[model samples]
Target: MLRVENLSKNWKEFRLKEVSFKVGSGEYFIILGPSGAGKTLLLETIAGIFKPDLGRIFLEGRDITNEPPERRGIAYIPQNYGLFMHMTAYENIAFGLKLRKFQREKIREEVEKIAGILEISDLLGRNVKKLSGGEQQRVAIARALAVKPKILLLDEPFSNLDPNLKGRLMREMKNWRKELEFTAIHVTHSFEESIVLGDRVGILINGEMKQVGEIREVFSKPENEDVAKFLGHENILEGVADGRSLNINGIRIELPQKACGKIRIVIPPESILISKNPLVTSARNNFRAIIHGIEELGAIIKLKLSIGENLLSAYLTKASFVDMNLSEGEEVFISFKATSIHIFE
Candidate 1:
C-alpha cells in the first residue's frame, strides 16, 4: 500500500494544503482534478522529484520521503510521454534497466516482454520523436513497466491523443494493469476516465484534497458545492434553511435533516424529473416551469428551465425526450425527491 500523511508543499502562488490519501496494493487510484490543481505536483512528490515541506510518504510501510526518484521504486509517465527525442523506442524502453546496470540479455528480455504487452514491438526500432502520439504513449508505459516498479504513475496520459484513440488506449491500459497486477496512481482532469479506469478516486481542487472514496460515491454525492460544481453538477445554488425546509428563489424543498440559515444545495441534472403532464405523486418538491432551451447530446438531452427567477438544468433520455415532444416554449412540471436534494452547511 502507498500512504501519504499530511503532505504539504509551497511553490510560488500555488500550494498543496495538507493533502493526504492512500492506494491499496494492486489498486487503481485516480487523482481527479482540474488543470493546476497540483495533480502533477503531487505525482512528482510521490516520485521524489520534489520533497514535501511537511508530512511523510510510505510505500508498503516503509518511509521513502527523502529517497531520490531512482530509489523510490516508482515509475512516472509525464503528460507529454517525456520520451527522449534522440533515442529509438527500444532504447527509451531500456533506459531504466541500463541505469540499474542490468545485464544486456536481461534488459533485452524485459524490454521485449513489456513491448509485446503494449503491442509496440514492431515500433521498437523506430525513432521515438517520429512515432505517433499513441505509439509514444505505449513506449513510455513500456519503459515504466520495464523497471517493474512497485507503483506506476501516469499524468494525463491520454490528453494528447484523439478521442477515439484515447478511448482505445484506456481499454488497453486496463488490460495491461490486469495482466501485470501493478499498483497505480493515475492522474487526470477527466471524470469519465476516473469512472472507467479507477477502483477509487480522490478529488483535489486548488491544491486541497476535498474528498476521497469509491469513484461512484464521490461523483454522486460530493461533499460541498465547490466539489459539486467541479464534478459537473449543473445546479449548485445558494439557499436559506428554516429547520424543516430549504428555500431558494421562492422554491421550497423539504430537507432530509433540520438546520437553519444559509446552505449550499446540489442537485445533479439527472436527479431532476420532468414531465409534460402533471401527475399526483408522493415526491415532496414540485414546480411548474417553462423550457428555456434544449440541447441534444447523443444519448441524453439537456433542458434548461426557467423556474420563477432562477434557471435550472435537467437531463432526459433521447427516447423519452422524443416521446414528450418537448419544445422551447413548452410548459412542464419538474420534481425531485427530497432525498435526492443534498444540502450542505
Candidate 2:
C-alpha cells in the first residue's frame, strides 16, 4: 500500500501542487494526465528521485518522504527503458540484482526466470542496441522485476508502442501483476491504457489532481467541466438552472435532478441519437439539426451537428451511416434522454 498526502513538488518550470492519492496493496493505480501535466514529475517525486517541497509519502504506514531513491525499495521503469546499450539483454536485466549484491547463481536464476516470463529468452545474449523497441521494453521490465521490488513505478511504459503491441503488452502486464501480486502505479495519457490497466485512476491536469475514483465512475461521470472535456465530451453547454429545469441558449431541458444558478452540461456523443426523420420515441430532448461535418473514425462515424447556435456531436456505426445515406449539410433529428445529460457546477 502507498499513500501521498498533500505532496507538492516544484522543479524548474514543472510543479506538482497538492497531489494526493492512495494505492492499496496489490492495486493497479493509473495516474492519467496529458502531456506536460507533470505526471512523470509526480512519479519521480513519489519514487524519491525528486524531493518534494511539502507533505509526506508513506508506504504501508512508514513515511518515506525523506528517503533516497535507492532506499525507497521501489522499482522505476522510465520511458526510454534505461537499458545499457553496450550490455547484453541478460546483463542489463541482471544489473539490478548485481547492485543488491546477489550471488551470480542466484542472479542468473532470477534473470532467466524473468526473461522466460517476458518471452525474451532468445534475446538474453543479444546486445540491447540490437533489440527492437518491444524487446527493449521487455528487457527493461525484466530488469525492474529482477530486484523483487515492493512497489513499481512505471512512467509511460507503453506510450511508444503501437496499438497492437500496446494491447498485447497491457494484457501481459495485467497477468504479470496478478501473478506477482505487487502494487503498481502506472502513469499514462492514454484513456484506453488507463481503462485497461487501472483499478482506479487519478486525472491530473496542469499538475493538479482533479478527480480520483474507480475507472467506470470517473469515465461515466466526470467531476467537473475540465474533467469532462478531458474525457472527450464534445458537447459542453452553459445553462441557467431553475429547479429541475435547464435553459441552454433558449432550448429548455428537463433534468433528473435540480440545481440552482449557472451550471455546465455535458452530453456524451453516444448518448445523442441521430435520425433521418423525427421519432415518436420517449426521448425528452429533440432538435432538428444540420450536419456540419462528418468524420471517419475507423469503424465509427462521428457527425458534428449544428442545433440552434450550439454544436453537438453524435456517433454511429459505419454501417448505420451507409444505411441512412447521411452526408454533410443534411438535416436530421437529434434526440437525447434527459437522464443521459450530466450537469456540473
Candidate 3:
C-alpha cells in the first residue's frame, strides 16, 4: 500500500499543490488528467526522482519521503519504455538484476520468467531498437517486473501505442497484474485506458487533485465543473435553480434534489433518448428538438439538436440512426430522466 499526504512539488512555472491520495495493495489506481497536468511529475516525486517541497510519502506505513530512488522498493517505467537501445531485450531485462548483483543463474531465470509472462520470449535475443512499439513496451515492463518491486509506477505507459495495440496491451496488462499481484499507480490522459485499467481514479487538473473515487462514481458524479468537463460531458448548460426545478431557455427540467440560485447541469449525451415519435414514459423532461447537425464517428452517431434557443448533444448507435431514417434539420423527440442529470454550482 502507498499513501501520499499533502505532497507539493514546485518546478519552473508549474506547481503540484497539496496533492494527496492512497493506493491499496494490488489495486490499479489511475491518475486521470489532461496533458501538462503534472501526472509524470507526481509519479516522479513518489519514486524519489524529485523530493516534494512539503508533505510525506509512506509505503506500507513507512515514511519514504527522504529515501533515494534506488532505496525505495518502487519501479518506474517512463513513456518512452526507457530500454537501452544498444542492448538486446534479454540484456535490458537482466540489467536491473545484474546491477543488484544477482547470481548469473538467478538473473537469467528472472529475465526468462518475466519475458515468458509478457509473451516476448521470441524477441529476447533481438535488439530493443529492432522491436515494434508493443514489443519494446513488453520488454520495458519485463525489466521493471524482473526486480519484483513492492509498487510499480507507470507514466503514460500506452501513450505511443496505436489504437488496436493499445487495447490489446491494456487487456494484457490487466491479466498480468492479476498474475503478478503488484500494486500499481498508472497515470494517463486517455479516458478509455483509465476506464479499462483502473479500479479507482484520481482526477488531476492544473496540478491539483480535484477528486478521487471508484471509476463509476467519479465518472458518473464528478466533484466539480472542471472534473465533469474532463470526463467528456459535452452538454454543459447553465440555468437558474428554483426548488426542485431548473429553468433554462424557458424550458423547465425537474431535478432530483431541491437547489436554489444559479447552477450548472451536465446531461450525458448517451442519457438523452431520441425518437421520431413521442412515447408515453415516466421521464419528466421531454421536448421537440430539431436535428441541426449529425456526425458519423465509427459505430456511434452524434446528433446536435436545437430546442428553442438551446442546443444539446445526443449519441445513438449507427444502427439506430439508420433504423429511424433520421437526417439533419429534421424534428425529433428527446427525453431524459431528472435523476440522470448531474448538477453542480
Candidate 4:
C-alpha cells in the first residue's frame, strides 16, 4: 500500500496544499485534475524527486518521505516517456538493472521478458529516437517494470498518442498490471480514461485534493460544487433549501431524503429529458420552458432551454431532435427525475 498524508509542496506559481490519499496493493488509482493543477508535481513528490515541505509518505508500511529517489523503490514515467535517445530500446529497458550492477545475463533476461509482455520485443533493437510514440511509450513502461519497483506512477502516459492507440495501450497496461500484480497511480485529465482504467479516482483542482472515492461513487455523487462541475456537471442550478426540498427559480425540487441547507444541484446534460409538452410520466420534477438555442454537435444536438431565468443544457440524439422538430424560439418542457439531481452543499 502507498499512503500520503498532508503532502504539501510549493513552487514559484503553484502550491500543493495538504494533499493526502492512499492506494492499496495491486490497486489502480488515478489522480485526475485539469492541466496545471499540480497533479504531476504530486506524483514526482511521491516518487522522491521533490521533497515535500510538510507531510509523510509511506510505502507498504515504511516511512520513506526523506529517502532518495533511488532508495524509494518507486518508478515514475513522465509524460514524454523520458527514455535515453542515444540508447536502443533493449538498452533503455535494461538501464535500471545495469545501474544496480546486475549480471549481464540477468539484465538481458529481464529486459526481454518485460519487452515481450509489453509487446515490444520486435522493437528492442531499434534506437529509442527512431521508435514511434506508442513504441517509445512501451519501452518506457518496460524500463520502469525492469526495476521491479514497489509501485509505478504514470504521468499522462497516453497524452501524446492518438485516440485509437491510446485505447489499445490502455488495455495493454491493464493486462500488464494484472500479470505483474503491481500497484499503480496514473494521472490523467480524461474522464473516459479514468473511468476505464482506474479502480478508484482522486479529483484535484487548483492544487487542492477535493474528493477521492470509487469511480462510480465520485461521478454520481460528488462532494462539492467544484467537483461536480469538474466531473462534467455543466447544468448547475443554485437554489435555497426549505425542509427536504429546494426552490430554484420558482421550481420546487424534492431533495434526496436528508439533503439540506443552501445546495447546488448538478444535473448532467445527458440526464435531462425534453418534450414538446409536459407529458404525464413517472419522472418527477417536470417543468415547461422555451428553447433558447440549438447547437449541432456532430451526431448529437445540444439544446439550450430557458427555464425561469435559468438556462439548462440537454444533449439529444440528432434523430430525436428532427423527430421532435426542436427549434430555437419554440416552447418545450424539460423533465428530470429527482434521483438524477445530484445535490452538494
Candidate 5:
C-alpha cells in the first residue's frame, strides 16, 4: 500500500541515495539495517517529517511525497515511545481523535477498543510517567492505532523491551495486524525480529537497498557476502567451485546444482556437526579438523576449528560438548550436509 521511488535525502553526516521499495496492502514489511544506516531518516521522510531532496512517495496509488504529516494518514511510533508524561494513557490516546475534532463519545470508544486490543485497558487511567517501559510502549502503540491510519511505521518498537515482553508484544502485534488488516513497516536491527514479524524484509546498508525477499529465501540464499554475514552466516570460508563441487582448504564439498564460479561459502555455525570419528552418514561433506579453542557463550559452546589453512566456527550445545569430552588442542571431525552450504557468487 506504500511505494517509494528515487528517494534521496542528505544530512550532516549521512545521506540516503535514491533508495526505493514497496509494501503491499496489509503486509508486514521490515526495513533491516545496522545503526547509522539511515533507516530512521527514510522512515521520517516517508512520514513527511523530513523533506526528501528528490523522490516520490505513493500510498494506495496516490502521490503523497509532499503531503503534510497529518494529512498523509500514517502513524509513526518512534524508538523512544514518544508519549506526553503530563497526560494519562487514556488522554494520550484520545489526543489525536480530539485534535481531529472527533466527538468525545467516539474518542472514548476508540481509545477503549485499542487499549483492550493492546492489553493495556487497566493502565489507561494512569499517567504515562508512572507506567513501566513496556506499559508506556503499549500505550504509545494504542494511541497510534486509535487513529486508524492507513499505514503504521514503527522504528524499533521492541528495542527497549525485555526479551520475554518483546516476544509477547510481537505475537500481539501479529494477531492485531491480521485481524485489522493493517499495513505496517517496522524497522529493526534484530534478525530474529525481522524473521518473526516481517512478511518480507528489505536489507538496507549505507542507504542502499541490498536485498528484499521472503525471510527464508533471503536467509537461505543471500545476495552477497555482506547480506549473508548479516543474516547470521558466521562460518565464512574461501572456496573454489568446480562444476557442482567446491574445494575449500583441502576439503571437497558437493554443492547444490548451480552455475560454476569462484565463490565464498557461508555455513551457519549451528549447521556444523562435531563427531568423534568419520561416521558414514547422509552428510555429503566431512573433514578432520583440529579444535583450536572452545569458548562458552551462555548456553551454547563455540568451537574454533582449523581445517588445513581455513578456520571455521561451530556451535554446539553444552550437553554435546560435555558428552563428547571436547577440549582445545584436540582432533575432531566436522561434517555438514550438502544443502547446508550456501555458495554466494
Candidate 6:
C-alpha cells in the first residue's frame, strides 16, 4: 500500500493543500480535477520529483519522503510520454536498466518481455519520435514497467489522443494493469477516464483535495456544490426542506431523511427512470413531464424534461429510447426513488 499524509507544496500561484490519500496494492487510484488544480504537482511530489514542504510518503510501510526519484521505486509518465527523441524504443526501455547496471543480455531480455506484454515488440527497433501517439504511449509504459517499479504515476497521458483512440487505450490500460499487477495513481481532468479506469477517486479543486471515495459514491453524492458542478452533475435544485419533504418550484419531492430549512438536492440523471407509462415501482417521486428536447448522444439519449416550472435532464440508453419511441414534445413518466436523491445544506 502507498500512503500520503498531509502532502503540501507551494509552487508559485498554485499549492497542494494538505492533500492526503492512500492506494492499496495493485489498486488504480485517480486524482481528478480541472486544469491548474495541481494534479501534476501532486503526482510529482509522490514520485519524488518535487519534495513536499510538509508530509510523509510511505510505500508498503516504509517511509520514503526524503528519497530521490531514482530510489523511490516509482515510475512517472508525463503527458508528453518523455521519450528521448533521438533514441529507439528499445534504447528508451533499456535506459533505466542500464542506470541500474544490468547486463546487456539481461536488459535485452527484460525489454523484450515488457514490449511483448505491451504489444509494442514490432516497434522496438524504430525511433520513438517516428512512432504514433498510441505507439509512443505503449513504449513509455513498456519502459516504465521494465524497471519493475512499486508504483506508477500517469499525468493526463490520454489528453492528446482522439476520442476513439483514447477509448481504446483506456481499455488497454485495464488489460495492462491485470497482466502487470502494478499499483497506479492516474491524474486526469476527464471524468470518463476516471469512471473507466479508477477503482477509487480523489476530487481536487483549486489546489485542495475536496473529496475521495469510490467512483459511484463520489460522483453520485458530491461533498459540495463545487464538486457537484465539477462532476457535471445535472438537475441541481435548491429548495426548502421541512420534515421529510422538499419544496422546489412548488413541486414537493419526498426526502428519505428529516431535515428543516434550506437545502440543495442533486438528482443524478441516470437515477431517474423514464417510461411511456407510470412505473408501478416503489419509487417515492414521480412526475409527468413533457420532453422539450431530445439529444442523440451516440449510445445514449439525453432528454430535456419540463415538469411544471422545473427543467430536468434524464439519460436513457438508445435502445430503450428507440423501443419507447420517445420524442420531443411528448409526455413521459419519470420516477426516482427517494433514496436516489442527494440532499445537502
In model 5, how large is the Cα lDDT of residue 284?
79
With a 3 Å backbone cut-off (N, CA, C), the pairs that clash in candidate 6 are: none
- Model 2 misplaced stretches (Cα beyond 4 Å): none
lDDT (10s digit) by residue, model 4, range 1-345:
999999999986778999999999889999999998999999999999999999999998999999999999999999998999999999999999999999999998999899889999999999999999999999999999999999999999999999999999889888998898898999999998899999999999988999999999998888898898888777888888877788887888776655666778887788788888777878777888888889999999998888889888999999999999877899998888877778766
Q: Candidate 6 residues 184-237, lDDT tens each?
A: 999999989999999999999988889999998898899788899899887889
Identify the candidate with maximal lDDT: 3
| CA lDDT of every candidate | 0.91, 0.91, 0.93, 0.90, 0.88, 0.93
| Model 2: lDDT of residue 300 | 98
Which clashing pairs does model 5 show?
A: 1-24
Which lDDT value does model 6 have at 214? Answer: 94
Per-residue lDDT of model 2, residues 200-276, tens digit only: 99999988999999999999889898899898988888989999888888888788689889999888899888899
Which has the higher lDDT value, candidate number 1 or candidate number 6?
Answer: 6
**Cα lDDT for residue 47, model 6?**
91
Q: For each candidate, what TM-score against the reference?
A: 0.95, 0.95, 0.95, 0.95, 0.91, 0.91
The digit string of per-residue lDDT tens for model 1 on 1-345 reads 899999999876667989999999999999999888998999999999999999899999999999998888999999998998899999999999999999999999999999999999999999998999999999999999999999999999999999999999999989999999999999999987998999999999999999999998999899877788898897887789999798888888787788799998887789889998784778887889899899988899999998888788999999999999999988999988888877766
**Winner of 4 and 5 under lDDT:** 4
lDDT at position 323, candidate 5: 96
Scanning candidate 2 in windows of ten residues, the lowest lDDT window is 174-183
Question: For model 5, how does the per-residue alpha-carbon lDDT over 15-70 read when each residue is reduced to its tens digit?
Answer: 89898889998889999999888999999999999899998999999999989998
Model 6 earns a TM-score of 0.91
**Candidate 2 positional error at 275, Å:** 1.6
Tell me the lDDT of model 1 at 226: 73
